[model samples]
Target: MKSKAAIMKTSGKIELGRRRAVWELPAELANLHHKVSIGSSCFLKLAPRPSKHWDARRAAELAVGAGFTLDKPCFFRSQIAFLSVTKIESLPDSVGPKMQTLMVGLNPSPYSSASRVPYGRPGNRFWPAAHRAGLISKDRDIHHALVHHGIGFTDLVRRTTRRAGEIDPPEFRSGFERVKSLIEWLKPKVVCFVGLSGWRIVSNPKAKAGIQPASIGLTTVYVMPHPSGLNAHASLKDLIGH
Candidate 1:
């Protein structure tokens, strides 16, 4: 008989394969030869295919009209496609328009994608630090707890990549508009970016990385060390400046 570990391994492999398949959708989008743009720095140039349906054209138009242009290759230099049709379950509840603090990260980890939970990564210290920093009351149901505290979590770029280095600066700039919209709606008083790398992506010429006490777009923007295990210096003290 197969061991329990063997069964678990097979399940894990199957799941990984499924996710890998989803990540490949860009290829299909490219096959349509639809010019598309993602964020501000990327573009796709292609002759519209005869077999393409109207909706594909419409999606392409939306892509181009939203600063996604077939006219240039300034953004996403390697590829271009319409935003993925994210499943409804992929998003959290609509955060209210009165947030006190907001936390932003570079992107979601594969574990977060798998669990459909924000900051769900086990290697990410966001939860523990927030809890200990008095951002949350214990670890009980962190999502609900955060909402209760007028706190919310989001990313600089909503797109998920295997690693943070895969992101482009233009994408962060493009996402800034969306971030502003969130802040306007949520009215968060403090906006904390996850790490130095993230701060640099959206930084002005004068601001430095590490802990910062600054403001951007009607919200106070604070720079904190990333909670990823990769950031060895990202202790609770390092982030909170204690």
Candidate 2:
């Protein structure tokens, strides 16, 4: 039988509430410790243990390979999402400050951590369109643009799970306060919310469904579809038009 401490060393490092831990696995399936964990941003889950076959090393490798820290384990039982306890990091201070376009997203995803880049997911199209739309200039280096192009990225919610919809209204409302504080302090020209959810949550408390671009305080807010491949029906042109 594998000891829990042994499993800890083999699991991928993950941040969890002021500390970190290795992802847990069933003691019964300890032989084949080399398999990948699976799931999306809202509800990542492990694959079924294959007939007494799974080992910590395999789990760690899979978690690392799949762009996740083992400590941030995601599990699903009866189709309900279960995320292991973990600490959510504060958004970078650099994400604030004067900008022409502030691109607000729902939250970070697992892949974002792996790449160490925001909006880095292959399926997410926010980067390409934002670049094409003149919001992000080709002439400017990434660091410069982040500081000067008046471009910054933030989220309506800061927590990252397998999916964005997992966030509730209160979470959205709380996120709005943080975003509002950023805007008040940063003083950007235009805040381009990446999706309708952001626009609603950040712009108007009464907003339930969706609404068009509206100004809030000194900032102008614009809404666009989320850039996930799920929005394939929508075109990059549509976002640029906003």
Sum up the clashes in candidate 2.
15
Q: How many clashing pairs per prediction, in order?
A: 7, 15
**Model 1 misplaced regions, further than 4 Å:** 1-94, 138-142, 209-214, 240-242
lDDT by residue (tens digit), candidate 2, 104-163: 777767676444456677867776776787767653233456755767666666546667
- Whole-model lDDT, model 1: 0.50
Each model's TM-score?
0.58, 0.56
> In candidate 1, which residue pairs clash?
41-74, 41-75, 41-76, 42-75, 42-76, 64-68, 97-186
Task: lDDT for model 2, please.
Answer: 0.50
Question: TM-score of model 1 relative to the true fold?
Answer: 0.58
lDDT of 1 by residue, 26-130 (tens): 223322212222232332232222222213333343332222234432222122222322121121222334578777777666666445455677776777777
Q: TM-score of the candidate numbered 2? A: 0.56
